[model samples]
Target chain A: MRSAFEWVDALPSSIALRESLNAYPTLLTTHVVSMCLFAGLIAFWDMRLVGLTLRKVPVSNIPTRLFPWALTGYGINLITGGLLLYSQPMRYYDNFYFWAKMALMAVAGFNMLWFHYATYKSVQAWDQGREIPMSARLAGVVSLVLWAGVVVTGRMMAYAGLMPEWWNNLNIGA
Target chain B: MTQSFFEWMQGLSFSAWMLEETWASPIIQCMHLLALVAFAGAVLVVDMRLLGRGLIKTSTARLARELDRWMIWSFVALFVTGAPQVLSTALKQYYSPFFWWKMQIIVIGLVFTFTIRRRVAFAEEGTLGHWPKVVGVLSIGIWTSVSVWARLIGLLS
Candidate 1:
């Protein structure tokens, strides 16, 4: 496992990105920008699903309307996040906050899947000017909390020093 | 003049507490990010309508009016939390290029949002020719710049 991280950190692209002064700032900026887009769009939809926003706007239309824009933002996030991880795989792998973020993201993904498979089919039936089903609202609430958790956890990663020295030092090689 | 103001702000008891308290900064930072979700989310929905892509069935005026409420409230919340964060790091922010850049973007974005975007969005449906589309594109561009620059201040600083 240590050798694997060493190899990733030693890769030509990683070295280039890690060595470049501008790469980090540029990537970090793009990463946040993507978050504003991705999380922002998701919030609108989730809020609607939770029966808090856009009540006049049909619930069925929210997902269809926002998916593309959200997807674009997600794509950008993936690229920038991948670059950041590539530059320092060991740092993230050892960080508790990073693991928390990934876990929350997995839960959010499942929540989305549950909505599409189980609840979304009945969306149009109770799409507008009425109470949303508990399942849909629950999914919406879960999505909101999980995505916000991801954001909070990502920021908390800066305090990754809370982890044990041996934990962070694992990839430095014996 | 500015030096004394910055010094005074940085020396404030609350600012000192914010700087020294490990939990304070991150909590305020989380508030800023959460407010951004509301502010930018509302903006994106309305902007998409302007661009004629999403929410095609919904009236632009209604979407704009409804979503603008969220945007404005979030802006106020963000400002409240953001002021302390800035004051805590007043001296550093005064000298930081990213801070000034974010200020510039926010000012310009406010102007555009209040004037052009608001007017066009509030106008009667089908009354404006191509102006709404242009305003939509401009709104997205300006807001994106503001968001990027605002977030960049933390990273670059």
Candidate 2:
């Protein structure tokens, strides 16, 4: 593994990306912009689910129509994220925090997909402006909890990054 | 279960700190911010609904429950991406009161949520009463504080 690091460290492209400011930062900027786009739409939909604003808008219409653009934020994030990873692969291989972030993202993605099928699948039946069902409401509650958890864990990821030599030191812990 | 796991993982290696420099770090940070928008927007919608802000004639239960989905999703997003960050800087934030405070607020907020659900389990469409309104306020306060502190975690680090 150490030898692999040496090889990786010596790679021409990695060296260039590591040295250049343009590669990662440019992508980082996009990541920020995309996030704004995505978060803005999702927040609106979530609020609708909570019955806060746009009461005139059907519950189903908010997520259904607004989702397309909000989802674009996720796509932008993925594209920008992939580029950054390509620039330096090994930094996160042994880094548990990085892996944890990946794990949370996986869960978030799975949850959203599950939600699309589980909650929204039959939504049209009761989405007639004001007669939304109890089941759908309960699903909304569950969805809110899960989403908040994802956000907290994501921030905690940044906090966790302060650890410097944890993985190798505790490779035998479990 | 998720909360417990986060605590247990705190004792890992110091090397976990590299997350601040990773290629995907910035992207995740952006997502973290995005989670706030989603959660806040969701919660505010709930609050306004409870206070008769929106969905004036909609069932409080349905609106509240529907909002639940976004809240859960937001948290999930934060956790999945945030854990790595915690592992990286465990020691720095381990004793930080903001960390503990965030947890406490979450617990309180959750309890309020449960109580609201319990009392209004069979509730039909109408404006929420005083208690649920208080809970709604608490929810907004605690969650907003949590977000603010979370941002602080980044700055302090």
Candidate 3:
């Protein structure tokens, strides 16, 4: 794994991105802009699932309408995020917060899958009701928490040293 | 006078604490980002609808009305979290051209959103013709610029 990261780190594109005066920041700005669109759509969708907001809109319409835009946002982030990783693979590879963010994202993905396959299968049964079933609501809560975690950890990747001694001690990379 | 005011702000105990405390800035930044997610998401939902892209079944007025609350709250959160960030480094902010540009753009973005954007969004369906699409494009452009400028403040600084 370390060697694979090392190999990517040595690529000409990575070297150029890291060395370029303007490209890195441009990439980062694009990443953040996309984040607002992606995470924002997902948050509202989750809020709807939890019966917090968008009560007037039918449940079936929410995902069908919003998912496309959300996916577009996700696609932009994936490309930018990949380039960012490409620019500095080892830095992220060694960063505890980065690993934590990846783990949180994985869990968020699984939660989405669970909601789609399990709870969402019966969405028609209660699509119009103000109160969704417990399973779907739980999925919303879990996704909200996990995505928020992802954001926090993503931000903290820049401030890894500020983490407590225990956290640093637990970081295998350290 | 403006520079002195910024200097005074930086000299405050609260500002000192915000800068001196290791975790304070990052925590506030996290809140700002979270608020950004909510705020931007709300904006996108309405703008997209106006563009005739998504949520085609729901009326634009209803979507805007439903999302207004989230938008306002998230904007408040962004302001609250953002103030400390500026205050903590108030003097630096005063010197940073990008910071000033961001503030100016934010003001423009806010006014445009509440005025022209709001009127278009709430207009009777099919009454405005291409106006909704133009407003949608303009709204997206203004808000995206605000975000871009905000990011540049840190990156350029």
Candidate 4:
């Protein structure tokens, strides 16, 4: 795994992206901006599922209407995030927070799949009702928590030094 | 006068603590980002409706009213978390052009969101013709600029 990352790190594109004066920040800004579109929409959808807000809007319409925009935001993040990782593979590979974010994202993905396949299959029966099923509501709560964790860990990646001495010592870069 | 104010803020005990405690700044920043997510979500809900995209079944006025609380509260959270971050490093922020630009854009965004955007959002649907769409686009652009300028504050200098 480490050798594979090293091979990618040595690539010209990765080095250029890492070394460029403007490209890195531009990518980062785009990533952050896109989050407003992606995560922002997802937050609303989750809230709706949990019966927090948007109760009047039919459950069926919410996902059908918002998923396209949310997916656009997700697509932007995937590309930018990929390039960011490509730019500094080893830096993220050694960072604990990076792995934490990846793990949270994986769990969040699984939660989405569960909601869509299992819970959402019966959404029609309760689409307009105020009372959401416990399973769907639980999925909403889990997703919200997981995504929040992803954001926290993602932000913390920059402050790796703030981690405990043991964690810092584990960093190969350190 | 502004420089003295910033200097005074930097001299405060709380500011000193924020600067001295390594965890304080990051924690506050994380709070700011979290607030950004909430606030942006609230804003997008309304703006997307205005653009004739999401929540098509619900009235735009109703959607705006429903999400208004989220927008206001989350913005307040953002402001509360953001102030300490600037206070901790007032002098450096005072010198950063990106910082000033972000502040100016934030002010513009707040004003635009409340006045023109709000009027358009809460206006009767289909009556405003293309105005809602225009306002929606402008609102998104303004808010997006706020995020961009905010990021540039740390990235540029």
- The worst-scoring run of ten residues by lDDT in candidate 4 chain B lies at B148-157
**Per-residue accuracy of model 3 over A1-174 as CA lDDT, tens digit each:** 888998999999899999999988899999999888889999999998888888888888978988988998889998998899999998887787888899999999999998999899998899888879999889999999999998888888888577667766766564
Lowest summed lDDT over 10 consecutive residues: which window, candidate 2 chain B? B11-20
The candidate, 2 or 3, that scores higher on DockQ is 3
Per residue, candidate 3 scores C-alpha lDDT tens digits across B32-147 of 99999999989999999999987888899999999999999999999999999999989888988888888898898899989999998998999999999999998888888888
Clashing residue pairs for model 3: none
List candidate 4 stretches off by more than 4 Å. Answer: A164-174
For candidate 1, lDDT tens digit of each residue in B1-157? 9889989999999999997897899888888888887888899889889888889899998998888889899999989989989999999888778788888878998889999899988888888998889998988888888777776776677
* lDDT, model 2, position B132: 59
lDDT of 4 by residue, A73-109 (tens): 9999989988899998988877888988999999999
- Candidate maximizing TM-score: 4
| Model 2 per-residue lDDT tens digits across residues A45-150 | 6545665555656666556445665677779978876666556666544556556667766775676677678877877776667655665655555555555555
Q: What is the TM-score, restricted to chain A, for candidate 1?
A: 0.90
User: Which ranges in model 3 have alpha carbons more than 4 Å from their true place?
Assistant: none
Candidate 1: C-alpha RMSD to true structure equals 2.4
Ranking by TM-score: 4, 3, 1, 2
Residue B108 lDDT in model 3? 88
- Candidate 1 structure quality by residue, lDDT tens digits, A11-47: 9999989889988889988888899889999998998
How many steric overlaps does candidate 4 have?
A: 0
- Please give, for every candidate in the order listed, the TM-score of chain B alone compared with the true chain B: 0.94, 0.76, 0.97, 0.96
